[model samples]
Target: MTVPRAMKSTMFTLDGRRGVMLACMAPAAAFFFAFWLLPTARLITVPAEKGWSAYFEILTDSRYLESILNTVLLSLVVTIATLVIGAATGIYLARRSFRGRQTLLALLTLPLAFPGVIVGFFVILLGGRQGLVADFTHSLGLSRVTFAYGLTGLFLAYLYFSLPRAVASYTAAAEAIDVQLEEAARMLGASRWHITRDVWIPQLAPTTVACGAIVFATAMGAFGTAFTLASKVEVLPITIYNEFTNYANFATAAALSIALGLITGAVLFAARLLCGLSPAR
Candidate 1:
């Protein structure tokens, strides 16, 4: 028996929709397999060629531990500083319209165009031995201070790059917030501090956490900055590069890379969980 015309059309439509959906997803699947899954699997298994014990060696080795600790601490500090500074600036820009506001916002986000190496160089120009800071201090007949090759320089560079991202995220989040909520609170005799505390912060908490997580992850994986600044900085990315290049120690580098990935992944996962639970949503 022949199928009904309507039913036949329905079957054909469903098949066409499925085909379109699969076609759309094909490139994504191919890209994920080629780039993400393959590389991640290789990274996870390469250290195992030395034995499973190699993974645990990251924790036992003082150098590896120190690099991990330094990366974590530095990323954490940068995240906090970037969020505070970016939120304040972003909120102000989002809430106000004034002369040069567009120009100022453009300038604030200009750093985003720069790569990590460029940011490192900028740090050197600001705080290197013959830099502005040194010149100004020398002119004052005081000691010339330079920190371009140290943790301070790394922190500043990370903050410089991170700020634009944080500001952009905060601007989007703050603009989405309802202005009437703040106005209602003000009419209820709430102090500015109270209104901000009870309304704005709670609304912005999820975005703040998300922006911080991104900054932390970027800082953790930053290699060019550390590479350009100093060989002695000992961040995990530099350590991994040294292990891979200097010593030809693939196992150690792979293991450290995995550890760094895990740590960053865990923090990002936690941040996502917190975002899901945020009252702002």
Candidate 2:
């Protein structure tokens, strides 16, 4: 079969494009397979004698089970809190054009620039004993209101980092939407309440979910903030670290890591699915 020159050239171009795409993706794929997949494989596919029994033991044990519950609770609470605060701030910023708006936005984003440890340190200094909150409480004649090394402390610390990320995500989404939609709703005799409930919220729902997922992941993997604020708290990350470092149990640590990874992966997957299921705007 004799092929036309143009058709042959088109086929060659398609093959070249595929090769280029694969080349572009190769580095990322290689890194993921080597660093991420390999470690995950080692964690999940080791020591056949122990088998799934290791996983079962961790899941069944009361202490590890409690750690799972506590970690999930913290992640959910912080995700919600960050979403609300960030969404409100993002909406406000997106809706208005004003003096010092840029300054305020930059300041809000400053936390994003700070290292996790630095932010954790400042959180300890600002919210812990002799810190701003503690000072205020002391002056109120209240008995030493402590917000250190506990769930409360961890929640506060998580918000410090999560808020900026949520704001960044939600702000991009909010900016993508047009203000005229609200104006059009107003012209249609829809009140502010109606516009918010019917228009803004539905439009923002997917973005909100995205922000929540990011915040959840941040809270899940956070170490420095959790270590400083909730060292005694037995969240999954801390548990994994303790098992690896303090107890020197690589198998248990690997098991914990796998469990944590599975839990996080499942939640993120569900969140992404929910995002996909959202009605097209």
- Return the TM-score for each candidate structure: 0.94, 0.89
Per-residue lDDT of model 1, residues 224-257, tens digit only: 8999886556899999999999999999999999
lDDT of 1 at 97: 88
lDDT for predicted candidate 1 compared with the true structure: 0.92
Question: Which tens-of-lDDT digit does each residue in 1-281 have in candidate 2?
Answer: 99999999999999999999999999999999999889777777662347777778788999889888888899999998998999999988887899998898888988988777877788778777778888888899987666666888888888888898888777778889878898899999999899999889999999887778778887888887777777667888888888889998777777877777777888889889999999998
Best by TM-score: 1
In candidate 1, stretches whose alpha carbon ends up further than 4 angstroms from where it belongs are 139-143
RMSD of 2: 2.4
* Candidate 2, superposed: residue stretches over 4 Å from native: 47-49, 133-144
Overall lDDT per candidate, in order of appearance = 0.92, 0.84
lDDT of candidate 1 at residue 28, scale 0 to 100 = 100
